[model samples]
Target: MALPLVPRAIAAQPWPALLSAAFLAAFGFVTLYSAAGGSLLPWAFPHAARFGVFLGLALAISYVRPSWFREIVPYAYVGVMVLLVVVLAVGVVGGGARSWLDFGPIRLQPSELMKPILVIALAAFYSAMPPRHIQTFGAIWPAGLMIGIPVVVILLQPDLGTSLLLTFSGITTMFLAGLPLKWFIGGGVAVGGAVPAIFPFLMPHQQERILILLDPSQDPLGAGYHITQSTIAIGSGGITGQGYLNGTQSHLNFLPEQHTDFIFSAMAEEWGLLGGIAVLVGLGVLLRWGTRVAMDAKDRYEMLAAGGLTSIIFFYAAINLMMVMGLAPVVGIPLPLLSYGGSAMMTVMICLGLLMGIDRRTRRDRERRRGL
Candidate 1:
């Protein structure tokens, strides 16, 4: 009986996804340890602690029924929107963005919470809509409202990174819901055409970022410093790396946000191209697992929810990687699980927990069908 119970419990868990997360989190811990000048006091310990706590939260969430998520999504969305408004009114200003709500010992970024909730809300919305109405404007406008409203609020917070992330996740869901492809193509062309008109209205710093992206040397000591240092660190790594805890840029304080937004740069400096590839491969495994969950979903809600949630992680990782590599403008996006921040970790773990729950449901349903 004891032997049977051991395998049964082990078989019940999603080990592949769990192990992948563990690998990334452990890598992040070591990188953070190095970033702290070989100390764990500032960043390294807290990061590991947060991952553990959030992982537990995710596991608890995994046991929840899918119907419970569908039931709470509307209320949860409304609640988060309220928090965003609260943030605008009295939020703590950090890194030049008034995006956090102070609660004595804790500072919460409501925008992070919106990522997962928006996915669930949209998933519920599309799953309930009539199949015949999916192709109609009725499908398009309501979903747009769901996405657009929060985006406007976040922009008021002036967090361009979060706003862009929300837009991407929302649009990904809309596409997954079977919105016409021509709409996306037309919208893309229109947005592209409108960029010139939009350029002048952007904040000065925003304009500088775009300009620097086009020509980093134009402001080598100013707006382009972050990208310049990041590239130097990455390029210096070459093949294997400079060796653990021996990264010159980070240890010497030349790499800004070395423990957070630019942690990858620090890792590559010490761990080399191989370390970068290891991170990529780990993320790839997790992403492949997520895509499989979405494809294996039994209901429309589960499918959209899994796909959208998975896309949120993808966008976070992709934008941060590109931003560091100079392929995109700096927008302050943090690498998921690897960055030294609780808010993003919580949001991501919530998504993973929800995905786990959906995957569990999918597996059980398959077994039931087989039993019949």
Candidate 2:
């Protein structure tokens, strides 16, 4: 049955998650304003416009029906594949990765959009099957095949970070869909055994990234420069931060990619640990709300969709934090709302909106069943 738009006799809707998202969005805007203060109007206006557009799109997506979402998943996945192929054919090269499709005035990165689409598609694909069917190697091969095609193509673009994210999202959705423990252990063992033989295929730069993670000092001014300077910025923040817009590391260009992939370093440098904690708290609230929605999901598809979305957000938060703290190799993953880029910011917003829509539908169903 199609769930109603609103819960019967319910006094209120979930505003905490929406409010938390709003606060984060505002925080991002302020930081962007500060980060791009000196850039020309032409350069800055596009970002600002993109932000506004994404915010509205998120709000619109929040009202969509769960059934509609399910129907759209396969199409969305196919659409992403088409765009990926298009990107490979005529992508503009930048930052050692040719992953962005150039559309003259605007550059589009399809991988960012593909993350959530892949999540939804995988969730729906798995949830439709019988649990017993998926437990064996025969049934799991199709699932692996679905994931492997895009993964291989994306990796051919040489976008290791995004390819990893895609793999992470797909595997997580599969796990949520009901994969057995033995499967995980077996997969881990396979990966462990293959790492040695497969290590030689990694690009030289990719190898350098792993080595820099081990000892950053080896190439202080080259591969390790980002980590070294980021650590300094984070440490310089001390406890309370150096204050907004006054960060020497940020303003003096000591920290690279201060507005995009490494924006957290700027936050740490300017707002210190306290500010970082604030962002974490906001993210925590959003995550908790997502989990609650997933638990209350009216069906397996919704539950899996909600869970997969939550995992994507969690992965970005955890990976970005680790990268900024120098605890993990820098993977060029943006810090959700805090980082710049239209595709990433929009994708996260869409995920939150999807969560809200799912919550709304489930609540309505509960109310209807109670005759309220």
Candidate 3:
């Protein structure tokens, strides 16, 4: 009897999450409008249009059956790997990274797509393996390969931001899958020890960003320009903000990447602390729904996918906000759904869609188990 109503319950749960996403996108559009000096032609319209298109694409992706997701994981992971290789051969360069593939009018970033696919593939891999193996060398090696291969490929593209995001997403999934806590502690120690050796290999600009993070005053007109200008913009906006479309820093061109990576600062300048808080609360709502779904997930696969995807969104939101405000080194991470870019919009929406897929599968599994 209760099983029959499960479908309706699942359908109703996403309204708050969906509304939050739309609202964030709308706020981003308005910021882009201001960023363009009150013109929609350049940034706002395309941003909104892409949101609509990806929202629809996400819906379609959500309908994929569990069996299909299982079957597609290997092929999807391999296909993205091939694209990563192709990118090394002839990838288009822009803004300091060669991560995009150009095919006339359509430019695709496979690394962006891989973030979520990595979640799916790893979840699928762990789902098939015996739970008992999760703590052994068997589980560690394969998962490390799944994560390490892409990290190496993208790091070579010199897109350190995306590589870190993938590593975070994959590791979060593994931890949630119940790997031994001591192993993570040991890995953390190893990673900490490796930093000294790895620091020299970092790109000059990347190293500069870290130095700026350490001392913003060191290169006020050079390396520190971004975060310095960004903090000013954020601090200028008081409790109620300077009013929408009235931010001076961005309008006067003091803020860099005002339409992309630093859009949140643009938003903070106009919307103020209140607006920032609102964005946080809104994203909190979206993530909360995902957390609930992950916690109540009906199976191991769904649990890992839902939880991993949720962690991925959290990663984007946290890193971008921190980078803009100077709490972290600038790594060129775009705010999820809010930043004016196609690649991130697609990645985040697919995450939401996949969560919806998990919800849908959870209901079906529940119904079937009850002989409904």
User: Candidate 2's error at 133, in angstroms?
Assistant: 1.6
Q: Where does candidate 2 clash, by residue pair? A: none
- Give per-model CA RMSD: 1.2, 3.7, 2.7
TM-score of each: 0.98, 0.92, 0.95
Return whichever of 1 and 2 wins on TM-score.
1
Any idea what lDDT model 1 has? Answer: 0.93
Q: What lDDT tens digits, residue by residue, belong to model 3 across residues 168-213?
A: 9999999998899999999999999998899999999998998889
Candidate 1 local lDDT, 141-174, one digit each (tens): 9988999999999988788899999999999999
Off by over 4 Å in 2: 1-13, 37-48
Name the candidate that leads on TM-score: 1
Worst 10 residues of 1 by lDDT: 1-10
Q: Regarding lDDT, does 2 or 3 come out ahead?
A: 3
The lDDT leader among the candidates is 1
TM-score of candidate 2 relative to the true fold: 0.92
Which ten-residue region of model 3 has the weakest summed lDDT?
4-13
